[model samples]
Target: MGTRLRLTAVATAVSAVVLVAASVLVLALFQRQVTDNADDLATSRAEDLAALAAAGRLPDLLTDIGDDSVGQVIGPDGSVLAASASLGAAPAVTDRLGSEDPVRIDLDGVPDDDETEDYRAWLVTAQGPDGPVTAVVGTSREAIREDVLALGLALLVAMPLVLLAAAALLWFLLGRTLRPVEDAHLRQRTFVADAAHELQSPLASYRTQLEVAQRQDDPAGWRAVVSDLLAETDRMERLVRDLLFLARQDSSASAMSLVDLDDVVLEEVARVRPTTAVDVDVTGVSAAPVRGNRDDLARLVRNLLANAVRHASARVQVACRQDATGSLLVVEDDGPGVDPGLRDAVFERFRRGDPARGHAAGTGLGLSIVRAVADRHGGTVRVADGGGGARFEVRLPRV
Candidate 1:
């Protein structure tokens, strides 16, 4: 949030600077055009008057420019030849240019305190009969100043409104985009609480059964009951372990490492053979290295083997080989192959195929765990036809 606020501030500052620059450009263009128009008008009038003075037609030309604008002509000695009353009584061009260079000056010709005030002037020059004549054309400075002030005020008002609108848009878009993250967090929290509650019941039942068996007088029956309870406890433990492994896979903090594919498969097959008919057959096994958590990869292999053993009639076959692309680990069972339509569904959590066929004892999380581990390693698992049995294949990239 702090970073976003800072970004918003930076955006506003950049917008303000850009708007101010545009307004400055507009104001400069307006001023240049206005001043150019004024200069052209004054120069044209001065030329007309200079021609009149040369032809001795001052009265006629002066009448022609009666009430248009203030005008004045000055000689080499800075003396005014003819001046207009549109310019109120004030210092002549000669007086205003008292020691300064004879340049244009924008100022009032009359005291602003007086009513019916005339505020105008134009300093100019022309070719007189004896020498070059100087003329001063005058106009009101108040109107020009007001126009500039109004331009500045408009820019100042409009810039903030634009920035405010932009900031509001940015805030709304950020909120909407991040809403999914909030929902994901809420879902995870709910899953954790539910998992804890689900785990408590089985654990409590196992503990009660064990305590009752321990206090019984006849030891043989109690021993068998205690053994079954221990088995149930171990099943719960395995489920919890599988759940923890999946939770870690979901977390963003986890990482993978390069592992030997052949070694992982052999090790897991050896680990599960102590309790089942686990057979590993690697005719052309590739010693390819892949990126994955060694422990999760081993667990994935174990789960696939365990699932096969639990349902196999006679044996489980494990094969590791490579193709043109990457390494492949195939676990085949001589039991009934999964139905063609149900292959994809078998990988889902708690999914059992044709429960009427056989009651296979499993927590139903094994294949799901296998899929998650394979996915984290940038690999995939699929079930395909294996002649007369089920074939589970895990394919991973060679690193």
Candidate 2:
């Protein structure tokens, strides 16, 4: 399955399990709570009856208990004295237990198996001057069963709806979260197709030019032309590399593991030193580790360095540092600083400063690639204010 489907399935399964467990817990607790309520009502009635009989006001006292509990009264010797109408015909009250304490028993009138009768009753006692009077409250067991069954049905009906709502929320969030990835993918595909078509014309022209230069046999002129063609080829190679990196990042196939950013910066600085004409400076050296794809990190550093060298007239400074927020990578070029208004525009793919004045051959994808890599690493890249030059800063979380 695709990643989205797998993630959705996992989320749905976990939600279902949790919802089912919660529903079961609520149902069980509700049933127990209701049962307790019934028992408490029965006990309260038994208490009121004991008080009435103790004061010699026993006549019809059982009827008053009828409101919340089925009531029947037994004489001091355990013979029936009164019974609630709802109970219809019950057994002798003396046949039940005594004391203010309550007990559950089967009722007399309802038929059970061929040999016995069926109905349920609570047997409780009332205190008397000489002995204890019994109060029996008979109720249908079906009452408790009906309440519990209703609760179970409610949960069963609600659970599926809850699960669907949760799944829908997650699905929407996933779409929003993956929007950037999808956009990058589409942009890359378009870039590849356009790049191929654009490169074909230049390559064909260079081939034709080389053939004509060869025929001339003029060493100086031919060498200059060959140099220009080689430069174009290098620009094409850089563009291809950037496109590949972006594709890998969007696919999330790039290796993301823990590495020391300080070390990577040092290595890149060393690599750039031999080719760069301007002086290089490294500062804030520390073991700043972060989780990232090492090769992408190297590419990001290389592009930033190349951009600095291409534009800097006097100095290029590279620094690595860590702070509370994250690891910071700063590259500054002591050349003509970028115009304040154009800093944002410079990062766009194929955009360059003063294109009319001609720039060293470049595919103009460096900054775009840098931003893509930073995003993959869950970091950011932005312009930093430099006193008399342009500065680009990259920030990533330190592990």
TM-score for each prediction?
A: 0.59, 0.52
Poorest 10 consecutive residues of model 1 by lDDT?
Answer: 59-68
Clashing pairs in 2: 78-94, 99-125, 110-118
**Model 1, runs deviating above 4 Å:** 1-194, 200-229, 252-258, 277-286, 339-342, 349-359
The number of the candidate with the highest TM-score is: 1
How many Å off is the CA of 277 in candidate 1? 4.2
Error of 1 at 147 (Å): 8.6
Candidate no. 1 TM-score: 0.59
**Cα misplacement distance, residue 183 of candidate 1 (Å):** 9.2
Question: Candidate 2: which stretches are off by over 4 Å?
Answer: 1-185, 197-201, 207-227, 354-358
Tens digits of lDDT, candidate 2, 1-399: 255566777899999998888888988898788777777776676666666666667775356654334666776765656666554344444454665457877655554334433345677776678787776665555676788898889888888898889888878787788777777767778777857865786789798888889899888897789788987778678777776666666665677899889899899889999996789888656767889989899989988888888888878988888889889999998888777777877777767654422486567778878898898888999887996888999999867
lDDT of 1 by residue, 58-148 (tens): 6411334434356665655655556665443333555543222235565444444354434344554455567666556655555556667
- TM-score of model 2 vs. true structure: 0.52
